[model samples]
Target: MNKVKVLVCGDVEGKFQTLFSRVENINKGHGVFDLLLCVGNFFGDTDEGLEPYRNGKLTVPIPTYILGPCSAVQVALYPHISGCELCPNLTYLGKRGLFTSSSGLKLAYVSGIEAESDTLSHHTFTDKDIESVKNACLRGQTNFRGVDILITSSWPKDIMLGDKGCSVQIEPNGSWLLSWLAAQVKPHYHFSGQEGVYFERAPYRNHSFSGSTPEHATRFIALAKVGNTLKHKWLYAFSLAPIDQMSTTHLYQETTDQTDCPYTGKMLHPSLSMKQVRPSQFFYDMDSLTDEGNQRKKARKDNKQQHKRQPPKFDQESCWFCLASATVEKHLVISVGSESYLALAKGGMVPDHVLILPVGHHQSLSTLPDAVEEEIEKYPLRTSALKKYFKKQHKVPVFFERNYKTSHLQIQTVPIPHNMAGRLKRVFQENAEQDGLQLDELPHHTKLSQVAPPRTPYFYVELPSGDKLYHRVANNFPLQFGREVLASEELLDMADRADWRDCKATKEKETELAKAFRCAFEPFDFTL
Candidate 1:
């Protein structure tokens, strides 16, 4: 097997002489060390400290990869000579780029610390830096197949506290953005500096990739600053065979056993670990349930003998789709109508699936006033405009309104191929029949507007052809039944994509989707 012996070190802080001596002795003893990896702060604390290496008075003995431009001088000089040899056997990895050594081991790095200043500094990584890494991954330049090694300056956020018994005194010195990117890249080994300990985490598998075969587990190591007061060993070493040379059997044998994390003391599963670090926000509107809301809750609890319960008044603060909530993702809003708006479905069943919702919170479409119903029906006309855009024969819009509980009323629109129109309705009808509920078709305006008492709970499906509507009224209906049918394991076989969590992508992909939909739906926007 092709194997490379690597010597990894923490922030050098201009300890090149000491670092060189250590590498020399270790190479002499082992006779297998091929490369020296420095995790940054390569130059000392002062300008005078870099003089020896700048003047060639000191030299790097082995092929060295420095994850920096940590010093002002190095930073100024990097723009011209990045990716070029800085000195004998020393190569400067650019600010943010991928590198492959002569031995064929691929590594990618992002240099600099997370800083508070707006101006770009020598040791600062910015939002643009994060975007570049994401774009590279999306463009396939970095290839989703895991890098052999990943080098970054600051330790990943929560790394220390994430494992069991790990010290929290270190503070959360790592970047949340970097932690997120690392999850996407799924590097085999992640090396970082700026932390105060020589900590090596047990490997954890990443399931970010979509295929059946699992990606390799990642081993993370954080190095202490070199020449610190305690004189912690500034260097760390590990051996890894070239990915191409490692057989399936050999790779499986090398995998880390899933066990409790040494730092957080939690079970070390990648999905669970990623959840702890994911940057996405999910909001449940507790503030909306004020004293009045509480009284309603108590009243409902007290009125157990009542056959029909009155629904609580709509609170804009608690609605996920309301324009008033700061948590609403404005980017996902394709267009706004006077009363209703079109927005991309989060964790959509397909790329073209969307949600049409009222600007204000309503318990269900059936309870909406007559004027509101007329305006909301136009949502189908807007969705139909996307037929040519999505290259589908027509769009199918489905709405589920449960009056039993408080919820923001919204209609779901999904593009379907012409051929699947019959099967789509049949599947839903069959599923409803299995649950002993009869299907009924209701006209958009008359169904609820003319009812003696408003229908509290109902589901409406407007098929692709647009002539027929499938309606069902029930005391209970499966939640998100529309999405489940479109992403059904038996029909679409995409049940896994039913949940947004399971189909999460990098921020870049989300932005791209939003931008595309916004442009496609612009002409049909009622608010315009």
Candidate 2:
């Protein structure tokens, strides 16, 4: 009742002999697993190996749970798409539904790849299958806690949200319906296959959710195909307590490296049934699209065509960073460029704390074209010249960017005492360690694009020596973490000044400070 041991494998693909032999050895050495769950394409290009199991010539050792057929040859092996005990200790999980074990382990699954058109074969699932699964999961705000495991034959779209250096593009091979289901169900562990590769992302926290506190972090694992030539990992093993029998702490234990949940957009409304939320629905609202563009995209996005993303241009009329914006404070401007600018931060923790930001509505550099991204990268390297500028004043600049729940990119620069320069990184590390946060220093010469790519959430910092530290942010990360660390006793000893609001200055004071900074920086200003 405390917990159940489980074994999971990627596409069995008619390699039953090879897969089970390993399972038998694992049981002998690592203790017996209660059940074996198989995903991806269960049959190989042919089913000659499976004929023995169908005719009782072979027996499955571990109690096995599997899905519907994925190919024409495998279709003859299943009795139907519904549940069935195909052979000794072998069970079919059926096409789609919630499956609960006697040990209280709950599993949800969707069989087969996504359909390309209105035509769906036995190896494909449709919008109706998704609706049926959603309704059967006991969606009573409380009873629908979450499943222990979720299985899918095809990997979900956008599963790469937390990984660095890439974004998952919607392609013919991926399943967006599965992605939507993952967001709604919030399973503890999501297992998928069929792409024939092995990838395991760091544990990620699901949204705080609909009228619920933050759920447990989810672990996603994509296993390789059985007996593949490339020698990828095809098997995974773990133990977990059933939700009903576990205490909150054990169920929700936070991992050191946590990432943003892949699905961050709004979900289908409760009032709208799956009938109302069509599978054809792709990207949600984009405010800038014209009526004609919206209509065309709404119809063809389901086709999975790759269209160039057009992030709305910066609006000087409403952008607070733009000089013409309604909220712009003219007195704080320090330097300007064609594509970037610098300004003194309001309510500064230190009098000279400043901000480096884009001149317009850019959200992430990773999303920009390569030419634009490269151009932006070159601009910051020039600021390294400021080292000599700050050296004259007996101080060094520490820059950090936290892109959590923010649109416009803002890099905050704080100048610490010159003697404290060497202690900067160590102090930040110690602060994070005190709070059980991880501060990973990047390898030497790691490019900015490799730091935090498009659609990923992160906290990044740059030391005076140009070393970079990164934290893959999780749910509820402290809003003023960098500020708090810098304000610690080892550094500034201004712990009480961590919150910027308490350290604000009046308009006249801010204006005077900006003028002074302008005078001091004008001689070495790169833009000037």
Weakest 10 consecutive residues, lDDT, candidate 1? 270-279
RMSD of 1: 12.7
Per-residue error (Å), model 2, residue 327: 68
What lDDT tens digits, residue by residue, belong to model 1 across residues 425-483?
Answer: 66666555543456665554446534424644555666554433444444434333455
* lDDT score for candidate 2 against the true structure: 0.70
TM-score of each: 0.47, 0.50
Estimate the TM-score for candidate 2: 0.50
Error of 1 at 470 (Å): 36
Query: CA shift at 334, candidate 2, in angstroms?
Result: 86
Give the root-mean-square deviation of each candidate in angstroms.
Answer: 12.7, 22.5
Candidate 2, residue 420: CA error in Å? 73
Per-prediction count of colliding residue pairs? 7, 1
Q: Global lDDT of each model?
A: 0.61, 0.70
